[model samples]
Target: MSPNVNRLRVIALYKELHRLGRDYPDRSYDFNGRMRRMFEKNRHLTDPEDIEKAIQFGEYIKSETLALYSLKKYRALKRMYPSDDKH
Candidate 1:
């Protein structure tokens, strides 16, 4: 699977966890750490397939379609250039 897919999964997990009121900082940190490890392990792969993954993970699940579209656009940009690329 692509890095983006993995990231999307992690993001979804975090979101779900937050929505369910699971441990906030801990869950987010754990997911982020896992994502980092995966990136480091897959250093040979391309940057990441962020766009497709973000879309698949419902990055634009807002109540309004406009908000969803805006989220999609924003996520598209994010997928192209994620902020947490320390790996």
Candidate 2:
């Protein structure tokens, strides 16, 4: 991908992740703050491969965040309605 395209993808991913961070599983962890710092640290890359790798890593983080949220909901449901087999 061209450098311009990579920049756009990174910006889009950053924005989406920041938005998703509002519903992050742990509010005490400063998810958005940490994400901003990490992205700032990696903002100077010029290599296409490195940028691509960073984008992929960002995608991975996004998926993991979603998984954590899903797991949280699952735990809530489990607590709300207990299974009867144990009794």
Candidate 3:
């Protein structure tokens, strides 16, 4: 892909992560600020390979975050409807 395409892709990923981070289980964590700093830290990455690798890592983070959200929801549901196991 062209450099412009990669740039747009990165921006989109950043925005998605920013939005997802709004409900990041830990309210004290500055997710948006941290994310901004991370992206700024990589502002010098001109190599396509490096950019691709970083993008892949960002995708991984998104997946992990979703997993955490799912787990939180599951825990809430379990609390609301406890199982009747007498073990």
Candidate 4:
């Protein structure tokens, strides 16, 4: 992939991570800080393969975070409307 495309992907991931962090049940500040630091720490990577791998990893994390958020929301909903069929 072109360098421009790779850079854009990284930027998008960073923005998405920050946006998702806002709704994190844990400390948003800490989550955002860790996300920022993870990217910053890897900012120096020059190898195309390594950069691709990192981007893939970021995507995986994003998916996992979304799943976790969904599960949390589901649990909250269940608590609010618990089933009457308690056995």
Candidate 5:
């Protein structure tokens, strides 16, 4: 994907995460946990940075397409729930 597309994809994930975090104030832990699970489960759906190597060497490894489940997303989630200790 293009840089712009990747950026937009990240932004969309950010927005979705933001909305999820905002929607369930009391169940934030559950929400975040679910998100984390989803991340872990789909950690291998696409090869973001190694497309060429994957194709050339036939070493294709399915990686999670959702970059939002990354560390950056965790940071953002922490920022959103500053007072939450569910982590």
Candidate 6:
């Protein structure tokens, strides 16, 4: 992929991560700080292969975070309106 495309993808991932951090169940600041540190740690990477790997890892993290949040929401909903079978 082109350098421009890679940069854009990185930026998009950064924004998405930060947006999701807002809804983190606890330690929002800690999460955000860790996210920023992860990016910063890779800021100097010049190898295309390494950068691509980082991007893929970031994407994976985003998906996992989404799934976890979804599960949490589902659990909350269940608690609020448990199934009749349980009763």
Model 5 spans > 4 angstroms off: 25-29, 47-87
Give one digit per residue, the lDDT tens place, for model 1 in 12-54. 6455533533322344556445544544554453445654554
TM-score of each: 0.26, 0.91, 0.92, 0.92, 0.33, 0.90
**List of clashing residue pairs for candidate 5:** 43-64, 44-62, 44-63, 45-62, 45-63, 45-64, 46-63
Q: Model 6: per-residue lDDT, tens digit, 27-63?
A: 7458788999999999998899999999999999899
The list of candidate 3 runs beyond 4 A from truth reads none
Q: Which of the numbered candidates is closest to the native, going by highest TM-score?
A: 3
**Over 4 Å off, model 4:** none
Clashes of 3: 0
What's the true lDDT of residue 75 in model 3?
96
Better candidate number, 2 or 5, judged by lDDT: 2
Cα displacement (angstroms), candidate 2, residue 62, comes to: 0.5
Report lDDT per candidate: 0.50, 0.91, 0.91, 0.92, 0.49, 0.92
Pairs in clash, predicted candidate 2: none
Candidate 2 C-alpha lDDT tens digits along 1-75: 888899889999999999989988777999999999989999998888888888999999999988888899999
Candidate 5 local distance difference test against the native:
0.49
Q: For every candidate structure, what is the RMSD over all alpha carbons to the true structure, in angstroms?
A: 17.4, 1.4, 1.3, 1.6, 15.3, 1.8
Task: Please write out the lDDT profile of model 3 over residues 1-87, one tens digit for every residue.
Answer: 899999999999999999989989887888778878888988899999999998998899889998999999999999998699998
Residue 37 miss distance in model 1 (angstroms): 15
